[model samples]
Target: MMKPLPLDKVYRFIEPGPVVLVTTAQGKERPNVMAMSYHMVVDDGDPPLIACMLGPWDYSYRAFRATGECVIAVPTVDLAAKVVAIGNCSGADTDKFETFGLTPLPAKMVKAPLIGECLANFECRIKDDRPVENYNMFILEVVAAWVDPERKERRVIHHRGNGTFVVDGRVLDIRKKMTKWPTYIRD
Candidate 1:
């Protein structure tokens, strides 16, 4: 027999995956980076898309909502402290790039800049905003993606709310036991 669990806070147990730094900006406006965990892949095929959730109260939420352009920077565990610091303050009051001394590289397809130190960077454009009004979610289409060629394998951080964090560890290879899927190619 099993006991009932609280549905409202299920994410605490699910460990909603890794935390990514979402950078957003508009022309003539200062850039913003919010440490975000509410993100997921929507489609893995051509013109891939992702979804990220940002509460209306977040200072960068308005910037993202208005410009619909942002960079999803996947930082490795090496940047855990910087990620925590960025998440602690508001971009509206602080220039996170200057405070953190993070290198901002020009993105290929968006106005927002990408974090040069991150493992991978995805330049995205908002495809839909209907959820921001309902569930505070934004569906984004990835316009450009970059990964550090020198790094063999980068470990990322995962947040479980509160002050708890998880670092990506070990390799789990179950592909041989599962159905072989077609190779995923990126254009």
Candidate 2:
């Protein structure tokens, strides 16, 4: 039998992708890292774009406005607690990188530095801001991407709200019908 529950708080079902650390920087000011899951790939073409929603109150909001750039760092199961810590604290009052013991590496196309610990990083620039003024949404274009070659097993975490998390486990590859893997814009 099937069940129909209340739809008032249904974000956990619609969230796309695993939890990611969104890094934002502006000029000489201290950079910030935020644990976010409200993001997804809006355009998968050559110059891929991402749709993200951030509260106007977040420090990264101002950083993105000032720098027009940000980076999405994909974390694994190892950084679960740290991700919660990063989300619990406010970057406006503390240096997240120093607090979390994360290393920042220079990015190729944006001022926002990449997280050295993440398995993958997406460097992006603001492509559209219409959602920001209306609904606090942002559409960013991925300019550059980096990945760690050493991490053979990528076990990322996904937030399910209310102190619950789900880890990515097992892979079911059914590529029999697919011709080939898609190529990135850079390729």
Candidate 3:
């Protein structure tokens, strides 16, 4: 039997992608990081494009608007607690990198630094911001990406809305069943 759920809680059911830390900076001012999950791949080709939602209310939005660049860092399940806490605070008052003890590493293509503790980091520049007025969404083009090859833990956490979260589990190899886009499968 299906139970009725409130329409307002629908986001918890349809939330997409893993929770990521977005880093942005304006000129020589200190960089800021924001915990975000409202991002998705717009294209997976060479120089991939990503779409993320960031409204003016977010402190990082001003930096994004000023520099038009950011770094999306993917954290593993182990950093779940810190990730949630980072979102609870405001970058306007706190230096998230220092407060959270997250290491910031320089990137080759962007001014925004990458989180050393994250599993992967993608340096991106805004490709389109036409949707910002209505959706607060920006389409970004990835100029560079980095990953920790030595780190063992790889499970990523997904936000189920509110304070709840789900960690990645298990592995299923169904690549052989893929009829189309077989090239996407990796060995």
* Best-fitting candidate, scored by TM-score: 3
Assess the local accuracy of residue 124 in candidate 2 as a C-alpha lDDT between 0 and 100: 92
lDDT of 2 by residue, 14-40 (tens): 667689999998889988999888888
RMSD after Cα superposition, model 2: 2.7
Candidate 2 local distance difference test against the native: 0.88
Q: How many residue pairs clash in each candidate at the backbone level?
A: 0, 0, 0
Relative to the unseen true structure, what is the C-alpha lDDT of residue 130 in candidate 2, on a scale of 0 to 100?
92
Cα RMSD (Å) per model?
2.2, 2.7, 1.2
**Model 1 lDDT per residue over 104-135, tens place:** 99998998999988999999999998887889
Ranking by TM-score: 3, 1, 2
Candidate 3, residues 1-187: lDDT per residue as tens digits?
9999999999999898699999998888888999999988989999899999988888999988989899999999999999999888889999999999999999989999999999999999999999989999999999999999998989999999988898998889788888797778955
What candidate 3 gets wrong by more than 4 Å, as runs, is none
Clashes (candidate 3):
0
